[model samples]
Target: MDSKNRAKWACFGEIFEAVAQQGIDELDAVEALLAALRNGLRAYGYRRQFTFNESGKVERLPRDIYPQPVPVAIWRDSGTPKGDLTSIWQDDPEEPEVWISIDWVSGAVESLDWELTNFEHLRTDFSAIRIPRKEADHLLSDLAGRPKKRAGRPLGPSSPWEKEQVAAALRMIDGGDTRPATAIATGLTDTALIGKALESQQRRLTWGIKTALTGNAKNSANNKRD
Candidate 1:
């Protein structure tokens, strides 16, 4: 190869190596930061309360720490129940660690993994909460109870998005929006459902009993005169 071409190839290889190293460094930094946060949250005892196991019947944790009040199960199969919290690397081969978020207020009972955001105080912020393997498995099993329904039309009669639109329309009706049925049938969520309904109601389309009576009286008087 020409010297110019050889030099270009060497530069490309060096660039690739640097990019790879940067990616690795980023992952390592994430891991280290989360590890420190999780340890601090646990040490503070904010989320160290005993909780009831819903899946396996009601049972308290054996080594419960918080004594004043036992930890209550935040959710059942209905809503998104609390799951194992952890800071796991995306490239990690092992399963995610089960952890809990300790609320600073009670120091007992765990919170959801998502409550921690960058908006909170860094030193006082929740880092991570690790749950035991058994608890993690139980939470996972509970989450898997209901099968996720498909979003788009999957050989079914109606799609989930369609259902959501209809539901939104009904909500508009309940809110006293006089949106026309035709507009609602169009299946626009924010626009047709809410906006159209609001516009329809602004014109006072629904005839009030008093207004109807007054109109009839005026017509009757005109007919008598004629």
Candidate 2:
């Protein structure tokens, strides 16, 4: 290992030890390790490309120009359920001269290894970093329960027309109108935006109804006692 790599490994070791000392769960430790690796690689002028194999179909995830932390659920979903998962970081998108590979089996990290190809002689004898697993099954279950992030350009600021439509839909919903009826009346075809606007209102309406029912039951009990 070169002096630069030795320094990087030392930094990683410090981070790993700090995370382990925090008494965090296995999944948290794994996430911390990944974050450390990504940050270190970014400092080393590496561009990261994420990909996963799902049901034997390999698909590359959207490339990130910035070093944004990817969610663990997305990583878990990239592989077959209860199967192996791998993430790679390379210095180049077309042809990477240096790269790091991390492999996981059912939410437990199996190996984290890196290689440098620019040397006069190929160097592939780096030892892998192994993290012991105590709650692999639990980790997998938790990851499965977490929602995966939708891959696409996020909706920008709502236009004035959209705001007006959402307001009209909410008003109709408040007046006991069904969502479809509100949509038809307001001419707002965006069901998703309407639903999002109504989410808090619906929750509050449900809570209010429950409270009213409970109050009625209490009044009836008082009347019986009287």
Candidate 3:
């Protein structure tokens, strides 16, 4: 959890303690107190996103819509100072405030640090405590007030296994060797090579499916065939 939310949860415990002595053992009172504490924490929340223009004033980006926090590696390349990100990001804030610092390892903006933050809440969620992946997702979904993010498009069917198979096939082709030799080099059995070849053929078919469905191959003979 971020420091602010951490403080809020801590304050909630304090509120519970103070009110427990008041003979308010009821759930409603406790819930109300917790809600009030959350509201107070929300009040202290600052705007992180912003819009900028040379001809006009900039408006603060809404916090509720902040992007999901992503873990980014900060590195300094050769001949450059450490923790300097001036080369990585845009030099001007004339664009929208799409990036914000959530937590820095060194507590300094220019320090070589890892920033852990949620960006675009539309695509992410936040929670009070860390949990296992399955439970964590369920908890976030329960707390989400807005529409949840989509699963997003798949890149392709090609994975590491397929990559190795393809590389082996290419090496065999380069050495003017036969398919059996390629299978041996790839550590795949003859049957496995046959399966992989079929899979590759299917992958090509799927790519064609995409082209036909999306009209992305408009100028190609592949499209003319349809």
Candidate 4:
């Protein structure tokens, strides 16, 4: 677990400790503790659907509202740096957060980095959303919250995976940010994350990004036909 998880779970102890120790004096600690306690009560809840039967009685529907999570082949490419995200999706916050991700080498979600939130629920429930990696890349890019490009110049990212933040940094430049300032803000010089801007590396990154975009588009077209 990461520091964020540890911090979140720590909220549970805030309330009991407040009274048992005769009240927590630290303001931030008190707030986090209280917030954690409140979250615990509401966080695990999920929506339940109801259906009206022929007899006019409201019947409780089965708990599995969605289809099981489908395991898919993880996209792999040397482009975009190591540990750079290949895929990401919105998680059901109500479910315990699992950073479930594809393990490309094994073609399995079961890996050291990620896990299914509820394997049983997935096995019995949740539908498949098989968007190709191409479309997925575009969708993921949008989800990352990039702004639309302006007319004068297209601000293509240095790395294929540099979606939202790159755009944000570009905006800073358009608003009169110096190279040094932009570099500092966006890690423009952060070669450590990706690598040196070599032409071959760029080609590979471009291909990966294109593959993701095309795959997502193909999935959408197929869905329409269905």
Local distance difference test scores for all models: 0.34, 0.39, 0.34, 0.35
**lDDT digits (tens) for residues 1-226 of candidate 2:** 5665444332223334443455545445456345433343221211243222354423234543432333343333222222123455555759765444444322222211232343221212112232222222233334345554568522321346444545555566568765443233335444454565555334333433344446667998888943
lDDT winner among the candidates?
2
Model 4 clash count equals 13
- Candidate 1 per-residue lDDT, tens place, 48-152, comes to 322233453232345434312212222111122122322212122364223333321122233322224533211212212232333333323333353544584
In model 2, the runs with Cα more than 4 Å from the true position are 1-84, 106-118, 125-129, 132-226
> Candidate 1 — what's its lDDT?
0.34
Q: Is candidate 2 or candidate 3 better by TM-score?
A: 2
Which of candidates 1 and 2 reaches a greater lDDT?
2
In model 2, where is the ten-residue run with the lowest total lDDT?
A: 119-128
Question: For all candidates, what are the clash counts?
Answer: 11, 0, 12, 13
Q: Can you give the lDDT of residue 118 in candidate 1?
A: 39
Lowest lDDT block of 10, candidate 3: 102-111
lDDT of 2 at 170: 55
lDDT per residue, candidate 3, 164-221, as tens digits? 5445545555577544432433343234346756555445434433433345345554
RMSD of each: 24.0, 19.8, 20.5, 23.8
Instruction: Give the TM-score comparing model 1 with the true structure, all chains together.
Output: 0.15
